[model samples]
Target: MTKKKLNFCFKGSRDYIHGTDIFNELKNCFNDSLNYENTMLDLSFHGIAKKKLDIVEDNATDAKVVVKFYDTNDDKKTYYLVENKDDIVCRYDYAENKIVELSKIDLDLGKINLNKDTSYSLIENIVALNKSLLENMFKEAFGKWYFTRLQLKKIPLNYYLIRLEFKSNFNFKLTKTEIFLDNESLGFIYFSLV
Candidate 1:
């Protein structure tokens, strides 16, 4: 008898599909076969900066939200950030299926003018609008596990990033799932089980 191998891959996106719509796209990626054994899941968002802010001081030309994973023999930590085009976010050795190096860059919040009235309003609205759907997605993906922390960062006139960390009920370790949003509205959601 021969064993069969399964390959899971999903890439999708659309305009005017922000909050729950994006969540639904993710939910459908697995086609009702999401593996609950994975211990952690991280979601990163990348989008165009709204025109209302002053972003010239930062000297940033292009930006994207990316999640870099550091996988050690013992543990793994997910680092999510909005990266400028000049920055080297991380190095991946596809043959080994792990990240070789991760370079961290701290954003100069002082240089960019973050309008108090509108800072993070986009992400805040998306999160607020899809809170329940996110909760349900977490439950469906992790079973007894729950999300431990959520982080949101706004890059004035560039991009924004969101990170969601999930906690497992048991101590077992496995490859974590990562979802990357390549663009804000006309975005591409890339899901990888590894």
Candidate 2:
């Protein structure tokens, strides 16, 4: 069998998992796919829910992580990793492995500072009401998959990106991963199943 690469670099609140656990969790998420739709769920929420996620987990670390986010819609599929400091933003290109200096932007304080804390929820809830259900959903879709990149937006946002690079171009499943911003539900990552 050909070798496949499964790499995941989670930023924000979910970065503290043991390397083994992270690998195992990714394996499980891809193995138990047959009965995901029938798993038992018991979930409830009180807000309008700014975002919804199909699967999620709450056992991560608080370390600084670098996530790589690629724009699938782009013809070149340009990957982006934003770094902001002192009101300056720099964008990196994965393919060329360098920063496109022309894309740099300088701001003078108004909104969206990478060093300041802002209050906004990117994801509200993980779709599965419980852990087992979440596990099953992940497995069924990612059992034979690998990752290509981890996309991250501007700094201080408390969220990054995960890019799946599968083993082959065969039957695959589409799913979402729950992301958070400092213990609060932030948003969902719709995994590309290609």
Candidate 3:
């Protein structure tokens, strides 16, 4: 019996917004409605597992946004707020780490400035947002397996790369998966089952 290795890698840019930056922008947009210090204290107390803000600029005057927050609480809940232009379309709370569509919550949104520059914080947020997706995709491609190593690197042209290696006892073939965002090519997933 021989031991085999499965390698999965994704390379490209998703242009994700930094968690802290977006949180600050939200605080500013809401004015006195959102208390900065108190919110920060609550987040510190509960701990932040993941945060991501994805903004899509439709035209010169219109934009759509999807903001998500995952906290390290006992419930492991995920909260999402979706906004189109200046109006919040809907809000959802996913409890127990399950993706369920629930009732809506009201949130007022104002003008938000999107940052296009790439930074380490943005990379970390992107990783946090996609970690579960990557795991699910890996399982779909090669069945359930535990990864042995993980590596992340910042590359040129505002792109980030991630690699995950898993040890296996079965041999398979090479496979490739393309990751996209709004019909645009964002990255790719390459893996070899061996």
TM-score of each: 0.22, 0.21, 0.19
Write model 1 residue lDDT over 115-147, tens digit each, in one string: 223233333323332232233333345432222
State the TM-score for model 2.
Answer: 0.21
Candidate 1 TM-score versus the reference: 0.22
Q: What digit string (tens of lDDT, one per residue) describes model 3 on residues 1-194?
A: 11111111111221222233343454344444433222211111111112232233222121222222222232221222322223222332213122111111111211111123223343233333233433443455544321111111111133333322222223434333333322334433233333
Estimate, for each residue in 1-194, the C-alpha lDDT of model 2 and write its tens digit.
11222333332333222222232333344444313222211111111111111222221132121222222332221111111122212222221111111111222211111222222222211111111222333456544322222222211223432111112222444333333344433333333333
Tell me which of candidates 1 and 3 scores higher on lDDT. 3
What candidate 1 gets wrong by more than 4 Å, as runs, is 1-15, 37-39, 48-126, 129-194
Number of the top-ranking candidate, with lDDT as the measure: 3
Name the candidate that leads on TM-score.
1
Superposition error at 10 for model 3 (Å): 19
Candidate 2 local Cα displacement, residue 103, angstroms: 38
The C-alpha lDDT values of all candidates are 0.26, 0.24, 0.27
Candidate 2 overall lDDT versus native:
0.24
